[model samples]
Target: MRLRVEFTTEPFDLDEAPAHALAAREVIETAELDAVDVGPFGNTAEGSTDGVLEAVDTLLRKSLEAGATRISLQVSVIGDGNGEGGR
Candidate 1:
């Protein structure tokens, strides 16, 4: 299975990127994923189910440890690798 994950860590800092945000970015960038897009408002990654799950786990822990008060995340099964529909 394949998954796509979108997430954000807060409290936001308009002046610069927060520690939590930087942590999240590092997790995604180094993870075994594809289609990575990171930005101030949100971030996204797509990969195999196991890869996405593992990355999410690390992201949550690191971001919170870096002082993120809240995290908003969404995950979706995008495909089954056979060109079939997802649930």
Candidate 2:
């Protein structure tokens, strides 16, 4: 099954979102993620459901650590589970 996962956290400035995205990209470095869509960050991103979820979760935590005033994020994903490894 595929999941269209989404969530809203605190609000963050657009300029700072890229930094968060860059950091979040590292999450894929040691995982089983098939790919990383090298675009979008901050309040948004697009990728496999699992990868997007993991990155959002990590970015939220990191944003808090970085003293981000408000880091709100939402994700809309689409996938076909029967088409495994197709993300």
Candidate 3:
């Protein structure tokens, strides 16, 4: 299966990106994912089930350790890995 993940780390810093946000970006950028989009307000990535899951694990741990008081996340099965809808 293929998955897409969207996430945001809270305690926002208006002046600059917070440590937690930076950590999350690093996790997604280095993971085996595609269509990565990291921004001040949110971030998203897509990849295989295993890859996305692994990245999520790392992202949560690192972001929290970096001082995120809250995190908003969503995951969806985008495809079946064979070009079929994820029905």
The true-versus-predicted C-alpha distance at residue 82 of model 2, in Å, is 5.5
Model 3 Cα lDDT, one tens digit per residue, 1-87: 999999999999989999999999999999999999999898999999999999999999999999999999999999998899674
Displacement of residue 20 (Cα, Å) in model 1 is: 0.3
TM-score between candidate 1 and the true structure? 0.96
Model 2: per-residue Cα lDDT at residue 40: 44
lDDT of each: 0.96, 0.48, 0.95
lDDT for model 1? 0.96
Better of 1 and 2 by TM-score: 1
Which consecutive 10 residues in model 1 have the weakest lDDT in total? 78-87
Worst 10 residues of 2 by lDDT: 35-44
lDDT of 3: 0.95
Task: Name the regions of candidate 3 deviating beyond 4 angstroms.
Answer: none
Candidate numbers sorted by lDDT from highest down: 1, 3, 2
> Where does candidate 3 have its weakest 10-residue lDDT segment?
78-87
Tens-digit per-residue lDDT, 1-87, candidate 1: 899999999999999999999999999999999999999899999999999999999999999999999999999999998877486
